[model samples]
Target chain A: MSDARTALYDDHLAFGARMVPFGGFEMPVSYAGILREHDAVRHRAGLFDLSHMAQYHLEGPGVGHWADALTVNDVATMKPGQARYNIFTNDAGGCHDDVLFYRLDENRWLLVVNAGNAAKMWPYLVARADGRRDVKITSGHGSRALVAVQGPLATEIVAQLVDADITVMKYYTCVETHVCGVPAIVARTGYTGEDGFEIFVDSDAASELWRNLFERGSRFGLEPAGLGARDVLRLEAGMPLYGHELDESISPVAGGQRWAVKTRKAAFRGRDAIVAELEADTHDRIAGIVLDGRVPARDGYAVYVGDERVGTVRSGSMAPSVENKNIATVLVTKAASVLGGSLDVEIRGTRHRATVVALPFYKRPTP
Target chain B: MAQPAGLLYSKEHEWLKVEGDTATVGITDYAQNSLGDIVFVELPRIGAALKQHANIGVVESVKAVSDLFTPAGGEVVEVNAALEADPALVNRDAFGDGWLYKIKIDASSMPDALLGPDDYEKLVATS
Candidate 1:
C-alpha cells in the first residue's frame, strides 16, 4: 500500500527534509541534519510535524470510566485541561501502545496513540466501546494535525501566536484557544524533554499554522526537525518509544514504566498480569547504557557480560546531549541492569565496553 | 552537481580516483547526503587486503549504519585519520578532504564495473 502523507508533507519537502516510510506514513526523517537539528532543539527551538500520530476524539460521561479500565493510569480522576501519559496492555501484560491522554473537558478527551499502532488501536477501541452507549470514539487519524515547537525558546516563540498567556500554563496542561487565528488545542507537553507546546488543529489549517510558525520561529533560530532527531532527543530524555521501548512483547512493568502502573486501582486490563510481573521482579527490564567509544550500539545488538549474553539493545543513538557519547536502551537481565554495572555491546561481532547508567541520559536543567 | 570529472564511480555509490597504482576512495555525494550527518566512519586498517565490491568498513550517520564497499580492491595503504575526530567531513566535502582511504592497486586490472562521471551522474539521478 502507498504510504499516507501528512498535511505538512510539502512543508517538509520545502525544508529539504529526507523523507522515509514510518508507521505507514511518508514522514521526514531529517531536514538539515540529525545532529544539527538535535542541537537546535537542545539550545534553540525546533519545529516538528507529528501529524502522523493518531488522535482519537472521545466524548461522553462514560469516557473516563471506560478509559480507566482499558489503560494503566487513572483516567477517571484526571481534571479537565490536564494531560497524562498512559499505556494500554493486553492480557499477557504486553503493551498495546504508550499514549498521551489530554483531558480537554470533563466529558471530552483526546487520546493520541503511536502512528504505527493506529491500525490496531482503532479497532481495539471500537470493539471495546461497542456495548457502551455513553462513550463515543471518533478517529481523527488523517483529519487532524499535530505540530510541536520544542526547546528552551519554545514557549517564547509559540506564545507570540497563541491567544492565551501560555507563559503561565503549567506543563501537562491543555487549553482550547486560537493560534494564528485558527482554532487549536494548545498543550504544554512534548517528548523532547524540553519546555514546549503541541498544537492540534484541523488538517486544512495545518499548513497555515506551520508556515506562520516557521516564518516567526526562524528569527529565533527555530528550524524544522524530523523523526531522526526526535528519536535521539527522546532517547536522551529517556522517553519510551512505542515500538522499541514498549512493544506488544514488552509490558509496561518490564519496559521501565512501572511508575505509570497504578496497582492501587480497582481493576484494569492486564492488571493481574502486570501486578504478577511487578511482584515477581525477575523479568528483564530496560536500562540506560553509554558506550565507551564512538561506535554506535544499534537495535537488536546483543549485550553481554563477559561470555554470557544478558540482553539486547532496544533503541540506540549517538547522543548529542550526553557529551556526544553513544547512548542506548537495552532490555537486560536484572543483574545486568544495576547502575554503574559494566556491560559490553557486541556490534558486528566485536564487543564494545559500556556502562549501565540511570534512565534519562540527559535531563534538562530546571529554569 | 555533476560528479567530479575524471573519477570512476561504483554502483554502491562510491568514487575511485586513480593516481597511478594508488587509488583514493570515498563515498559519492549522493551517498553522504542520503546517509545524513556522518558521526563515525570505520575504515579498513592500513596494510589490509580487500577484494573489489566487498564491504571494507562502515559509515554511520546518527540514524543508520551503512556498509562501506571497496570499489576497487588492493592493499590498504592509508586510511583517513582526520575522520576519526571529524566524520562530518564526509558530509562537508565527500570527494575532497573526506576521501576515506587509499588503496595500492594494479591500475591495469581495475574492475570493469566502474562508471565514468557521466554514467555516475545518471546513476545518482535515477537513484
Candidate 2:
C-alpha cells in the first residue's frame, strides 16, 4: 500500500526536508542536516512534525476505569491536566505499546500511541470497548496534527504564539488553549528530554501553526528537525523508542522500565506476568553502552564479553551530546548489563571495546 | 547537476583527478549529498594495491553506510588524514579537502568505463 501523508507534507517539502517512509506515512527524516538539526534542539530550539503518531480520544465516566485496567500505570488516579506515561501489555508480560495519557478533564482523556502501533492498537481498543455504552473511543490519526518545539529556548518560542501563560505550566501538564489564533492542546511534554511543548491542533490549522512558529522562532535559532535527529536526541536522553526498546516480545521490565510497572494495583492486564518477572529478576534487561572508538554501533549488532555472545544492540547512534562519542542500548544478559562492565560490540566482524554505562548518556543542565 | 570539469567519474559516484602518474580520488557531490551528515570514513590503508572499481573503503552517515569504490586501479600512495579527525569534510567539500586518497597510476591506465565530466553529469541527471 502507498504511504499516507501528514498535513505538514507540503510545508516539509518547502523546507527542503528529506522525506522517508515511516510507520506507513511519508515523513521527513532530516531537513538542513541531521547533526545540524540535532545541535539546534540541544542549544537553541528545533521544531518537529509528529503528526504520524496516533491520538485516541476517550470520554465518559468509564474512561479512567477502562484505561486503568488496560495499562500498567494508574490512569484513575491522574488529576485533570496531568500527563502520565503508560504501557499496555499482553498476557505474557510483553508490551503492546508504550503510550502517554493526557488527562484533559475529569471525564476526557487523550491516549497517544506510537505511529507504528496504531493499526494494532485501534483494533485492540475497539474489541475491548464493545458493548460498553458509557465509554467511547475515537480515532484522530489523520484529522489531528502534532507539532513539537524542543530545546532550551523552546519556552520563549512557544510563549509568543500561545494565548495562555504557558510559562507557569509545569512539566507533564496539559492545557486547552488558543495558539496561532486556533484551538490547540498545549502540553509541557516532549520526547527529546529537553524543555519543550507539544501542540495538538486540527489538521487545517497545522500549516499556519508551523509557519507562524517557524517565522517567529527563527530569531531564536529555531530550525526544522526530522526523525533522524529526533532519534538521536531521544536516544541520548535515554527515552525508549517503541520498536527498538519496547516491542510485543519485550516486557517492560526487560526494557528498563521497571519503575512504570505498578504491580501492586488491584488488577490490570499482565499484572501476574509482570509480577512474576519482577520476582524472578533473571530476565535480560536493557542497558547503556558507550563505544570506545568512533565507529558507530548499529541496531542488531552483536555484543560480546570475550568469547561469549551476550546480546544485540537494540538502538545505536553517534551521540553528539555524550562527549561526541558513540552510544547504544543493548538488550543483554543480566550479568553483562552491570554498570562499568567491559563489553565489545562486533561491527563488520571487528570487536570494538565498550563500557556498560548508566542510562541517559546525556542530561540537560538544570537552570 | 553538472559535474566538475577535468575529472573522470565512475558509475559508483567517485571522481578521479589525474595528475601525471598520481591520481586523487574522492566521492562526487551527488554521492556526498546522498549520504548526508557523514560521521565516519574508513579509507583503505596506504601502499595497498587495488583493482579498478574495487571496493576500497566505507563512508558512514548518521543513518546509513555506503561502500567507497575506486574508479581506477593503482598502488595506494596516500590517504587523506584530515578525515580521521573530521569526516564531515566530505559533506562540506566532497571534491576538495574531502578527497579520500591518492593512487600512483598513469592516466592512460584508467579503465575505459570511466566517464568524462559531460558523461558523468548525464549519469547524475538520470540517477
Candidate 3:
C-alpha cells in the first residue's frame, strides 16, 4: 500500500478492520462485512471515519462573490451557516471535483474536497484565487478530521450523543458545538440520502471523539462503517463520486448537476465552454440504471441500447439494501437520457435489461 | 473458521464433496467470507462438459463478481436450482444446501487434483 496513515489509523486497527490504500490513505475497507455495515446504516445508523477528505477554510471581506465565481453554484444568496453542493470544472468544462462549500460565518467558509484531488485541487485553487478579490485559502487537510454519522434515525442518535441542538439545525446547516466536551462542527449534511450529521474536529482530538461517539451511539445500532458501506450507501443515494461518476473527461451537466453550473455569470474556468456545450446539448450524459438481476455490472461493462454500443457503466454494485438487483450509474446518450428508458449492460457476455430510474433509491423517512 | 473435513477444496476457494464417481461442488467458506454477502449465482447448465479451472459458474456478491472454477474435468450432471431464487444459500450454508453443481467424474481419480483442507487453509490465510 502506497497510501500514508491518517490520524485515526490506530482506531481502525483496534477495530479489526481491513485497511487498504485509497487515494493515498490507509483507509478501512470493511470491519465486519460490506453487507453488514450497509445494513447497519440502513436499519439504524453508521459512523464513518471520513478523516481522509481534504478541508479548506476561506474567509474574507469578499468571500461570497469570490467563492461563487470559483464554484458553479450561486453561493452569493446563501446565508451564514448554510452549505451548498457544488463542483469545480477545468478549462475544458470537465468537472475538476465535486465538493460541499460550507458557509461558517459571514466571511468564513469551509470547502470539503475529494481526497485524491485535494493536492491537485488545492494548488489549482491557490493559483486561481486572485489576491485582489480579498480571498484567503487555508488548507486544513493536516489539521482537521471528519466523521459522517448517517441513517434513518440519525438525528436522534446524534442528539443523544451531542449537547447542542443539532436536531433543529435543518438540512445543509452546520453549528459549532461540543460532543463529549470536545469542540466539533456538527453539520446536517450527508451523501447517504438518510438524515445524518458530519462532525469536523481537530486532528489531535479526533480519535477520542470518534471513540466516545461510537460507544455512546452503539445502543442505537450504529456501526463504525468503512469505505465499503460508504460506497454502497452513497451509490444508493445517487451521489457522484470523483473518479467513478465523473472526472476530467466528463461534463457536470451530464450528471444532472447543471443547476450547480451558473451560466449567467461573467466567467469561471470552464464558463465559456460549458455555456457553448449547453447550447449545443453535447454527446454525454449520466443515467441511473436498475438491473433485472443481482449480479452487479462492473466498472467497465459496456452498455448497449438494444445491440448498439451506447455507453459504459461507471459505478455498479448489488444493491442488497434496496433489492437483490444490481444498481448502476452509466454514461449514456442525451437523446436516450429520459427516465424509464430501457437499456442493457453486457455482463460477461450476456446483455441484461436495466431501466433508468430516479436517484436516491431509498429516501429517509422524516421523523 | 476451520475447513470442514472430507470436503475436497480448489485453489480458487471452491469445495467439492465426492460420493463415488459423482461429486458436489460449491464455493468454500473462504470464498464467501471474501465475497461478503452472496446475492446471486449463475450455475452451469446440466450435462455441460467442464475442464478443471473452467468458468462454469459465477457468484455475485454485494461487492464483486467471481467466476466459479471446476475442481476436475467432468460433465455437469445437476445444478443446485435453489440458487436462482435464493442464491444467499451459498453464503448461509456453503457446504450443505448451498452446493452449486454435481459432476460425474470421468475416471477413478478424476482428471485433476483437488487441494486438501490443510492446503486450502493455507491458501486462504495468505490471500
Per-residue C-alpha lDDT of model 3 across residues A1-367, encoded as one tens digit per residue: 4687778899999988889888778999899888888888888989888888999988787777876676677777788889889888888888889999888888888899999998898998888675656788889996899988888768877786677888678899988788778888889998777788999989888888888878877888898889988898888888888888888888688766787787877777688778888899966788888998666788899999876888999999877666656889999887556799889899879989899898767666666
Pitting candidate 1 against candidate 2, the one with the higher DockQ is 1
Order the candidate numbers by DockQ, best to worst: 1, 2, 3
How many angstroms is residue A110 displaced in model 3 relative to the true structure, after the best TM-score fit? 1.3
Name the candidate that leads on lDDT.
1
User: Clashing pairs in model 2?
Assistant: none
Clashes of 2: 0
lDDT of 2 at A146: 98
Model 2 lDDT per residue over A169-244, tens place: 9999999999988999999999997999999999999999999999989999999999999999999999999989
Number of the top-ranking candidate, with TM-score as the measure: 1
- Please give, for residues A233-276, the per-residue lDDT of candidate 1 as tens digits: 99999999988889988999899998999999989989999989
lDDT of 1 at A337: 97
Q: Which residue ranges in model 3 land beyond 4 Å of their true spot?
A: A130-133, B108-113
| Prediction 3 TM-score vs. true | 0.94
Using Cα atoms, each model's DockQ against the true complex is: 0.87, 0.85, 0.71
Error of 3 at A74 (Å): 2.0
- The DockQ-derived docking category for candidate 3 is medium
Q: What is the C-alpha lDDT of each candidate?
A: 0.94, 0.93, 0.83
